[model samples]
Target: MSHDNSAENPKNIDRANNAVSWDNSIRLFLQQAGSSSPTPGGGSVAAIVAALGASMTSMVGNLSQGDKFAAIHERIAEIIGRMNRLTGEYEQLLHADISSFNAYLEALKLPKNTEEEKTLRRAALHEAALHAIEVPLRLMESCRDGLAEAASIAEECNKNVISDLGIGVILFEAAAQSALLTVEINLASFKDEERKRSFEQKVSALTQEIGELKIRALEVTRKRIAGDMA
Candidate 1:
């Protein structure tokens, strides 16, 4: 008899559907997310939120194009390209978040009847948990970078869509906070104090920076929308 080993490999797991959450419509994604399954939880939701922020940034960039805005057309084009790429990266992070969590679930199911089996299970769980943390950390980093790009284009994008840039910053802020919570939860599984503290420090700094960027971006957005940017 031949045995299949697909389930043993996290990369081989079926992520074809959930990875592209927007392709099936947000309604369907929300339905599945609200189901009893726990795969597409906070982490996946954060990725979607961040992606929406990037999309909003790109939307503003696209609106800022044309001969009327020829003075900064090249810079706006570059911003649009960067925002589009960030959107794609966030979508990929959705897959990574789901897979990493599922990998932890698989590790949890490993045999623990003997000392050797228990040792192996512990190691697997440790690795899986770290990966889970890494996914959210990456999401937070992407949110920071995306917000920076959004802020950069806030004053330069079309005045008609200035509010959209603020909306993007708000979304990015929420996603970063959500991802931070996920990272904190995963950090609970770590037995090494030094390693865990390192992650804590990193998340703290990221959260602070994200918050500052949100404030700056929103200020620009408000000033532009109110015609107060003298």
Candidate 2:
């Protein structure tokens, strides 16, 4: 009998530990999300939503090709590349959010019976809490950036797919808003006031940017669909 040790490799072990793939059915994911499990929670949902938005942006770009669009072909190509990159980033973020939450739970389990233990536990908790906040913060930032790229080509893309770009921007806004809520919830329990305020400022700016981008993108989409931009 041959014994296999490939799974024992450190890199493989790490991958197995941190893996959070969502390549399964949407219904399966939804069922798991709706279950009692705290994971695949709001943060993961936000990340996936952002991924879908990026995918939609890429789809619009792909459908907008032709001699009729020669002038802005380069711009559409650029938007597609950026949206592809954002889609990959959002997939990673989905895993990061779940892992960060799990890390916080592990930190909470750290022993705190003595003064030294309490100090160590507190440090662990603070680090975990910060990681949790950072994951969602990155999601918010990515959504804001993705929305900008998606909005940039909204009016120039194929008229048939204009609505998709609009829907993509809306998804970006929703994801950013959801990520913002996750960050704020974590901040509520966070101990560092100065850091909290800094994060809050970013959240506020992103909130405004996301909302404005959605409105502008959708307006372009509406105009094009209604033949006003023709």
Candidate 3:
């Protein structure tokens, strides 16, 4: 039985162990991000920001529910559920994005000394790059969805925490835009013209939707804020 070099290599062990993830504290995550290591980079950070936004959306929704909001209590509860789920999903995606990019790095290390080796290496790299592209694209889609959900929260959530909703909107918009940028970076390596074109179209639509949702959420949030102030 042959030992798999990719699995048994000391370098591989180091990388697998070193990759930063959601289980780590914010302090640890930020420390890793600031370190020379590149695994916990843009894609992971984007997922984290988006998750925070979703969590905040859930926070506001849960806080707003009571006799004060009895008329729309159920709707607020539904939004709470959705935001909570999105927060969990985004947290998972944070680890996934880090793994995908690391897989690409591993693909780069495949033996390419001979014709057969070169062909295998090329195929592996192509597959890994596609997976890498997929991670950030999913991140964008998740953030876009979170933004839309957060926008809806402004409509019926507690007026007192309207500022929290507003903050969540900004964070969601930041995550969506940053995740989209990360997708654009990876898209360059996705060589399948047809699928790449399809993905790009989805990105365009997602960006437009994110923009509109942010506009509406902020407008509603500010109006309520002003009304409260006056």
Candidate 4:
């Protein structure tokens, strides 16, 4: 879970160009999720969640850039700034996703024919699962934080952009759900029941929290929109 800020460096034009170009990277990431490959699995999805959160943050910022909401420029700018930081963090998560997958795949190669080998393989699996767990946990945290940003924007952002905030809320909710699924899937593969129970409980708590946030965001957005229409 090492975080690298280099990906966001302005001098790294090549990396920035390729990452934001929106060509095959996202499609490939999604494709790999469906593929037999394990590397781009949960971690990649978590990174995507973070990306989506950042994207929504950007959307809110864009909507805030004009006339009526000018008073809130500082606040919107802060949200955008945080999203920028999270974007870099998400890129690092992408690397983490690959590393965790590779660790699991390598662990799978341990010779299970011998008793000692079986023990090694089990250890590897546990380690791999732990790595896998980190990806979603990080994503859950990012999404939750992003939700707070969205809430702020929804409360104070330009009325014209109210729908965009709603969209951000929905996107954050989706990211949260995606991350939760990843956590559950990885936890299911764990060999220790105690560890599994612990992780499951945390995941359940996250699920409930996300559900509550989703409901609140939706209600706020709806009322805001209705008020505007009225």
Residue-by-residue lDDT tens digits, candidate 3, 88-121: 8887887777676567667767998999999998
Worst 10 residues of 4 by lDDT: 13-22
Higher-TM-score candidate of 3 and 4: 3
**What does the lDDT read for residue 140 in candidate 1?**
94
The segments of candidate 1 whose C-alpha lies over 4 angstroms from its true place after superposition are 1-22
The per-residue C-alpha lDDT of model 4 at residue 102 equals 56
**Candidate 4 structure, TM-score to reference:** 0.77
Minimum summed lDDT over a 10-residue window in model 3 is located at 1-10
Candidate 2 structure quality by residue, lDDT tens digits, 1-230: 00112323443233224435679689878876676554466877898899889989999999988898998999988888998889889888888876775565566668889999999988987887898788888998999999999888876788898888888888998999888888877788889999999988988888888888888888889999889996
> Each model's TM-score, in the order given?
0.87, 0.89, 0.88, 0.77
lDDT of 4 at 151: 78
